[model samples]
Target chain A: MRNLADEIERFILRKLAGETNDITILQRNELADELSCAPSQISYVLSTRFTAERGFIVQSRRGSGGFVRIVRVPVQKIVYNKPDNIMDYCSPEDFENIIIKLNSERMITAREAGLIKYFLDVIDDYVNPVEKMRIFRSLLITLENNS
Target chain B: MRNLADEIERFILRKLAGETNDITILQRNELADELSCAPSQISYVLSTRFTAERGFIVQSRRGSGGFVRIVRVPVQKIVYNKPDNIMDYCSPEDFENIIIKLNSERMITAREAGLIKYFLDVIDDYVNPVEKMRIFRSLLITLENNS
Candidate 1:
């Protein structure tokens, strides 16, 4: 929260945390007003932080009633059981460790682990570190609950 | 046996081989005449060989002046070095088995395999199986060669 960029990222991440599938639909101008920063600053942060390499999919619409939606998609809510701080910023390795620990304790079967691992394998390709965590958590949760 | 399709396939592969990152482009009808075949045959080989799953990104333009561009993209070649049959229709398990064998043989380290496994974990989630294959193969190849 030191810099404006980090602040915006945090605001978005926090908003996404309480969402289903880790997706948050919001307007750029409203977010800029809330952050007391320029709208272009929001765009800058998003462009650099939320990227395909980082696992974020950002879409925008222009003109009246236009909006910007930042989505960390295909991720569901059950993966992160950590404290809010940790859950807000997690890693793929963090996910791997949790699943591995779960498997070791017999909380999940090997097949389930494989399925969870499969989810991890796919979402890990997303590049945004912050988004990577939420995406991993949500997908793991979905797969865990589904299976 | 020099099947026309195989001949056309080899001709394109050979042409791509001598280029940077192993990419090449050609006119469909022109290549057909060079191989003494129909334009549709060129499309067949490209549709098969230069697939996203097979580690290729093919972009083509239609109409009288249309051309097809076959880009090798960022993936290295060795990931596709399995037997022809294996390469033709490989699965996630096939890739996993290959990496495991390589690990056991110490051709790739546990760390390397882990890295490969990481890529495997993420790319597996791609909805398109063909894209999943190519993305995994290219990333794995890049990791293997770099490490």
Candidate 2:
């Protein structure tokens, strides 16, 4: 039997899959009621599985008309033209995260993502902070141009 | 007034420009005689101006029918799938040469090549030998995939 977290994640993914856009909105209490779990359980699943590193952005609204919004960030949307934004993504971890996110979103194939990650892993130690930023920028630009 | 070397270079370039292919074959003596220069001058221009690093491969066949063949290497031709070949092109100089050659060939725009070179230049000092190899392989694969 699958755990509650897995069930909730699958449920949310199914909702997103059925939608025309890469986004889905839900009422926390209603989702909890339908899943027969606590609202906190839904929050836990959202916070853990649907993260920015995993190519998802979850926005939780709290009020009388409260709802949760989940948006899947496109690979093209992450490309930054500004130098400061480019500098922000200068680490190997950041790059690997982007690759993983791209793979998960089906923007890039698993084989290509795996190969890119393999190279990223090997060169992490030698690539300095500045080089990492430049590489990340170049990669994003390449991807943007190709896309 | 243009020097003999400049004249010879331009003459050869114009000949190449007129041709349908990126390659041109010339009889050294005939070319020298036409340009009012010595055969050695043609040899000098071929050796110095048209080199592999400068994107031209000059093949000189000596005999009764001696001919100098200049072939412009396309950007797609430089992509290597073999591990050994990838390893051979691990140096910063090699990467820069590729960028220059690609730019000269109009395979990649000057701005794109410049951006790539700018990033490549800054990262050279920090990238280790193994890392350089990985980076080169990744870059080539990216270009190949995009192309």
Model 1 C-alpha lDDT per residue in residues B17-134, reported as the tens digit of each score: 7887656879998999988888887888888766664446789999988899888644333445557324544576877787776556444445445545555565555546666666
Q: Report iRMS values in order.
A: 17.7, 19.8
Native contact recovery (fnat) for each candidate is 0.02, 0.02
For model 2, residues B17-112, the per-residue Cα lDDT tens digits are: 887768788899998899898899998998999876677767776754568888777554455524654444356677777777765555555544
Q: List chain A TM-scores, every candidate, in order.
A: 0.49, 0.59
DockQ of candidate model 2: 0.02
lDDT for every model?
A: 0.64, 0.69
> Any runs in candidate 2 off by more than 4 Å, and if so which?
A81-114, A117-147, B1-147
The positional error of residue B47 in candidate 2, measured at the CA in angstroms, is 62
Clashing residue pairs found in predicted model 2: none
Question: Worst 10-residue stretch by lDDT in candidate 1 chain A?
Answer: A74-83
DockQ of each: 0.03, 0.02
Native A-B contacts reproduced, model 1: 0.02
lDDT of 2 by residue, A23-75 (tens): 89999999999989899989988988987655678987899999999987655
